[model samples]
Target: MNIRADIFSRLSRTDAHLFYLPPCPTPPFHSPPPQKRSPLHSRDKSKEKNVLITGTSLNGIGFESARVIAKHANLVIMTGHNSDRLNLAADTIKRELPSANIRPLILDLSSLDAVRKAAGEVNAFPEPLHVLIHNAAAPIGPFKLTVDNLESQVATDHICPFLFTKLVAPKILSARTEHYTPRVIFVSSIGHGIGTGVNFDTLGRPDPTRYVPMEAYYQAKSANVLTAIELSKRSKGQINAYSLHPGGIYTNIMNPASAPKEAVEGLHKLGLLEADGTPRKDATLKTMGQGAATTLVAAFDPRLDDKSGAYLNDCVAANELIGPPSSDPANAERLWNLTEQIIGETFTF
Candidate 1:
């Protein structure tokens, strides 16, 4: 497929550009080129490092991150809501790397209690955690509330992850050494530019009348950026926290069944999807490996050691394109305080 032509045609036709596809060129799916790894990663012994990743569906970014990190991480914990799928992902990774150490932990980020329980279990583990990757997120779904009565998107995207991070922070801190730097990576989206900003007053209140699925998604993603920024500040160089747009990949997050028929058809009309609705095996859409590049770089790159809290895109710091709103310190502080209030915990640091 002619990716450049398809994106251009789509851009010319659509006035509402809420969906995020990176403008950068992508390699074809069948032969995705290898990405560069951090030199620092080669010096580390896999058995000495511990990593955790959320939302590890078989073909998603999280799963890909785990697959790549497995070669360097001693123990990689992959978490998801379904035990069956998590086990399958673990098996798939094992098939490729026979000696890979990976474990599956069930966690529904939409539920606060589940997040807390999962965090507790992880915290009890003796190993010091060196990496935390919040790669799980939902697409625009029907408006609903969790047991905590908070909007599902915000809860899954921000609230629960925030709580889980707080609960497991001590372990992350303990893992840090002069040679090892603990890292936190949040997989955000360029769609964050579409949000109208966080509304603290109506944050958790579920109002069907006021719910706009795309806006809700955008707000939650924006909160991810804010969370990473604030978390980096609080860590004060002890940990590196970064948020990034993982390029436009055709994962389950972009499932046609969950989108408006017109939008789906529009994407299909462009050469982005096949007749069967899967992403075309062309340069138009990124393969899972391509989408996971920025995340892998953020996790292990030594060059990024002092660039904590930066928003990355296309595998480099991209605060300029993400715009001022994402970097606004005021918004980060506000979101941090609001998250603490909602989670009912104080992270003093």
Candidate 2:
């Protein structure tokens, strides 16, 4: 009766078995340009490839992702809602790598105006943006509405990311060259398979009367996968879009004190947590580096170029685990169109 186990069981035996193993360490992060340099090589010196990531609070996957990416990327823009925490995260990265170029941007995903203003700042930057990581997500909670009157979890997890990506995609597109293509990565979760499917009828406007906290979360995560799939299709090789499940890493978001009491108990029953409430110390429970590994793979792995739209786990493609709801192309389009409807804007690409 374990939904996650059932979902994993549906994967090919090889991939399903790998799910219980740690992700293999990757080589150095950089990808050297192809030997046949083009005129664009002259611009590379001035136009250093930049990476922007959201939700980089302390000790979380986002912060770890920024820290790792800053080691090699020319510029790493870290974002969060609180300036103090965002600045601290960036400073921490700088202290670790003295030469690392870390820019902390304040972003509050609950507000549409804030999303627009943040996207404007990213667009105004002089250099091209080579990678965009949607690492922020709403914490598990009861049904609540944002200032925009959308469900808080869905608004933060899906609507805001959708709008921000729409606005900033042009910057990512402009960075494309013969040897380098911009990448868009969504840090989705295996929880995506918890729900039977997304309920487009009431996605943005969830009925608090019938709200289920974890169900809402799963739906939002599924949207992440659908968004990546549709983006890969629409970009038509112009960009690489990928979504992944960063294994269960115990961050503040998952702390029993911060997460709902019911949710914590459910995780225990599911064997995801130890009796004391910490994440279980198994291959399924990853370190911050291991949790961020899939994101890095999706971001820099040349092997993923032809595997765009892939849903990765344990650093390898595992689309079979996403199930028919998330894998259906028509559903992906429907979700795309519904997202536009929710945001009141259409994205052509």
Best by TM-score: 2
State the displacement of the C-alpha of residue 268, model 1, in Å, after optimal TM-score superposition: 8.4
What TM-score do all the candidates reach, one by one? 0.82, 0.85
Predicted structure 1: lDDT: 0.76
lDDT of 2 by residue, 1-349 (tens): 3323332322221122212333343222222322322221111121355999999998898887787777667999999999999998998888878999988898899888899999999999988899999999988777788888888878898899999999998999999999887899999999888787787878866788877878888888998999999999999998899999988777876688777765676577667886667877652565576677778767876666689899998677888889679888999999999889888889886
Against the correct fold, how does model 2 do in TM-score?
Answer: 0.85
**Where does the lowest 10-residue lDDT sum fall in candidate 1?**
10-19
Each prediction's Cα RMSD?
7.8, 9.1
Writing each residue's lDDT as its tens digit, candidate 1 over 1-349 gives 4442232222212210112333455323333322332111133333457989999988688888888778767899999998889899999989988988888898899888999899999998989898899999855667778889999888999899999999999999998888767999999988777666666666756687888777777788889898899999998888899999887778775667655544345446556676656777773566576677778767776667888998887667878766466678999998898888888899765
Candidate with the greatest lDDT versus the true structure: 2
Once fitted onto the true fold, the runs of candidate 2 whose alpha carbons sit more than 4 angstroms away are: 1-48, 274-276, 281-283
Runs in model 1 with CA error above 4 Å?
1-47, 257-283
Ten residues in sequence with the least summed lDDT for candidate 2: 37-46
